[model samples]
Target: MRIIRTPASIYLFSISVIGLLFFTFLIKIPQHSDWIVMFALSGSILLLNYYTILIPPKGNSLSMDSSIYLASIFLFGLHSTLLVLLIYSVIFAIIQRKIAWWKHLFNFSVYSLMIICSYYAFILIDGFTGPISVKNIIPYLLSICTYFSLNLLLVGVYFVLEATENIINFFKEILKETTATYISTLVLSLVLVILMKPNHLFGLSLFTVIAFLLSLAFKQHFNLFKEISEKANKDFLTGLNNHGYFKEILEKEVTAAKENEQPLCVVIMDIDDFKKYNDLYGHIQGDHLLQEFGSLLKASSDAANYIVARYGGEEFSIIMPNTDRKTAYSFMNELRKKVNDTYYKGVEGLPYGCLSFSSGIAECEKETYSVSELLNKADQAMYAAKNQGKNLVQLYNGHSEYSVQRSLSLEKELEEAEFQLKIFLSKDVYTYRHSKRVYQYAVDFSRMLNLSVDERKTLILGALVHDIGKIEIPRDILNKKGSLDPHEWEFMKKHVTYGKDIISTNKKLEDLIPLVELHHERYDGNGYPYGLAGKSIPKLARILCVIDSFDAMTTERPYQKTKTFQEAIAELRHCSGKQFDPQFIEPFIAMIKEFETSGDEQHKEVAASIVN
Candidate 1:
């Protein structure tokens, strides 16, 4: 219904007008005796529609009204069928007056069109109208098929117009779900025709009663199944999704987030000093506390469609789709304050003298390989919050963990990176020189952009190893001296992945993986790897792309011609938004012009300093 407005309104209006015209032309005045039968059939259709049988799981329904209409068409012919339709439509419109008047008119038109088409199809196929016989089976099948196809076409067109994405998948799902149900309903109509051949009123009465009973039986089964499913998926104590079910949903959401390139976050929280409260009170009182805590979490998270689950004793988790880590931290921090203010029984005996919790958030990133890894990051952050005296929210930071282990100074880290870069010297000397020049440009550019001390270090280090993946490429391709073939060009692109894998061997350098893998991505979403566009790529990676491409354009490569500094700057201007980020490219060009204006000797001195 939300899909019907403007163009859809006009579409429905046109179809309804055509249907009314068809109904007016096809409808005939029934004989005085046949009027009684038409009214009876119309009443039967109304009753059947009112008591539609809802299938379990998805809540789709089976309405027997179509069977009644098909039986009427076969028994009483076209005029009687239209008369039944008219009576049913008028009464139904009056009963369901709460629905929009236009929608009612549209529905009437759709049914009218279906009846008209099916009647013509039956007649054209030489269907016999008075009795049920084996000879007319082909006509009966054709007419029912026509009715089914017309319904699918009309409804499908409207929905397709409403939501254009995945149009082919939509029709396939509709056909798969509805084909069996529709076939059974149509076959039932034939059974009715056979029964009514002897006596109209008695056969109609028996069919209605059987259908009503079947609807009641199916309703009971659907209810039972729903209740059992809820029990299986929910935690008995907290009334939230159980650990297994939560993991199941998180895995699926993780896959969807990766495929659609959307942000997803997970928060793991633990109640601070919960064991103290449990020791003071019995385990039964602790159980009650857990229940209350789960209820609070569920109520707070319901508005965001977040999946909240009891991860274990005193620990709870929430999976937030399309949310980043910063937003997740803010929300959880607010919840922490709220929990502190809202007191629970015996919380006075606790450390903070009220309810309190520690939470940590981790956002999905390009480097996040699996759900377990993401959960581990959140767990680490949660422990970090606990170590910070509890009752706080922390966002996962990779550097925080590495600082505790290695804690290498910047100069030492630079030496480690330079050692890795030296491998390119023997394998591909051109690449080694290019990387060094790019590294130098990055140092100057980072200072010009007013980057932080840490950011400046990361940018310079990442620039040095960004092309480390090229180590895996064949020497013939790297120093080809001419254009590469299509296959060879594809093999050259694997260098980014190789670099990422190479750096991943050392946990301290995990922060540089995005720069190594994503520096080749374009600003307009045309680059290789993930094709991430605009700000979705990391800020450092975007800055590095401008520097990398600029150096590649100005420097001499075996297979490419070199451009002067002036020509390179002009090329950067032309491809600002396409190949490089406009925000960083303009500043980088300014820095190059500064070097050009200062003196050639100053630029050589900076290069010599980098070599030292």
Candidate 2:
């Protein structure tokens, strides 16, 4: 009903119904002699439809009714074919009354259109109702192709109008999924035409029986495939999803969350003092305890649509989509309390007595780079919970002691990031110098903002390596004397992704991924790779963009005319809110002005170095 309610869909459906009636009565009608054969063919279609083959692996159904219809068209001509369709549609509608009445009528119309067009095609190509012959091969192919194409167009358009599928992808998926099945149908129809030419009723019966048998065989194979696939993805002891399958689900959910701009949380939990329990109760009892715990986790989270997985050893993980860290912490804390109160055999010997676990929650943020990074954060949080006694729930805090330690290692990490940055010196001296200038600006701007020590360190390190992705660009494009062509410009834009990939290789530098990948993002949502807008862009990335762009505008390049510092500063001011964030522009401009007015020896030294 919803599908037919749309104007385009209603028009298509109405035209199809009108076309079917016009062709059935005016253009063609079954002769008195055609009644018996029509009934027989209709019966065969209903029987074949009931016993459709269940294809293996994906369990897609393959109906042999199309082959029967094609064979009827080839053997009995247009009038008998239409009569048979009329009988089959009426009988199918009666047997399938649970389906909506409009759906049944729409299906009948679509089939009628396919049969009418295909019959015309067969006749136009000099096809006749007779025994198979080599001379009629072209007609057979053309008519069957017409039937298939019209089926796709009519049905696919209805789905597209109803908002059920994307048109291009719908066609592509249908062609890929149905090609082999349709080919088999074409061959089977030809065989049926050959058999029915000599003895119509007997040939239909034999083909129907064989198809039914094959359907049964394929159904068994499909069942086996599903059985094996289930076992493969399930853990043996706990019966939850295994480590590999959990990762797959996490990756898919993370990607979906990022695209939909929804929150996702991952919680890593470990059974507290499990080794001590195993030492007191032996491995067999430990196995039982794990099974009980796994069942408890499944019971607790399944109602909320959380995916629970065994993360190996005594650790378990839960993927909670559309949940923030605070909600995740609350859910996990309640579970932790429930677990602590629940009694298990041999638990009295463990550290806290009764069953207990520690959990850590990490919410996927706008700047969270990868699933691995998310998991690492949760794993760290879980460990932090464990360090603060056994039964506890902790949320990941970016400014926690771990972050302080990371900041303390800024000098060492900066040295490593610079070593990577130096690769650009050989590739593009302009980019190398540009990165260094941005780094200096970041240092001054960070201090001016009075940011936290960790913030200062991260901002400085991020600016230093923000353009490290440029190393992947071809030197010719990197140093092109003229403006890059559109394709070259698009290719150059991939540096951010390349930089993210490069930084992700080293886990310690993963914190800088947002800045490296998002520095090109604009405040107004017009930039790539993701067009993140306004405050949604990370603050460090926003600052880095200001520095990166100002340096790019002022610094010398072979490709375009350069602007002076004063001109670049004016341009920055003019583009505020549209390109640069308004809050940071004046402070940055002031920093540059202070350096210029000071007539600093450092500037002269840097100028001398560049000239040399």
RMSD of each: 6.6, 4.9
lDDT, candidate 1, equals: 0.85
> Candidate 2 lDDT, tens digit per residue, 202-250?
8888888899899889888889998998899999999999999999999
Candidate number of the best TM-score:
2
How many pairs in model 1 have backbone atoms within 3 A of each other, for residues 3 or more apart or on separate chains, i.e. clashes? 1
List the pairs of residues colliding in candidate 2. Answer: none
Candidate 1 clashes between residue pairs 3 or more apart in a chain or in different chains: 469-499
lDDT string for model 1 (1-612, tens) is 576457666778788899999999888886754677788889989999988887877767899999998888888888888888889889998999899998988899999999999988988978878778788789898999999899988877777666543457668878888888888888889988887889898888889999899889888988898889889989999999998989999999987787567899999999999999989998899999999999999988997778899998899999999898878888898889889998799999988899999988889875464687688778867887887889988887744442233234544677888888888867888788788888888878988986645567778889989999998999989989889999999999999999999988986676678889989999999998988887667788989999999888887789889999999999999999998889887788888888888864554554456445
* Residue 153, model 1, lDDT: 82
Clashes of each: 1, 0
Point out where model 1 deviates above 4 Å. Answer: 1-18, 29-57, 61-81, 90-103, 117-237, 242-269, 275-288, 303-307, 311-334, 359-465, 468-475, 494-517, 530-540, 595-612
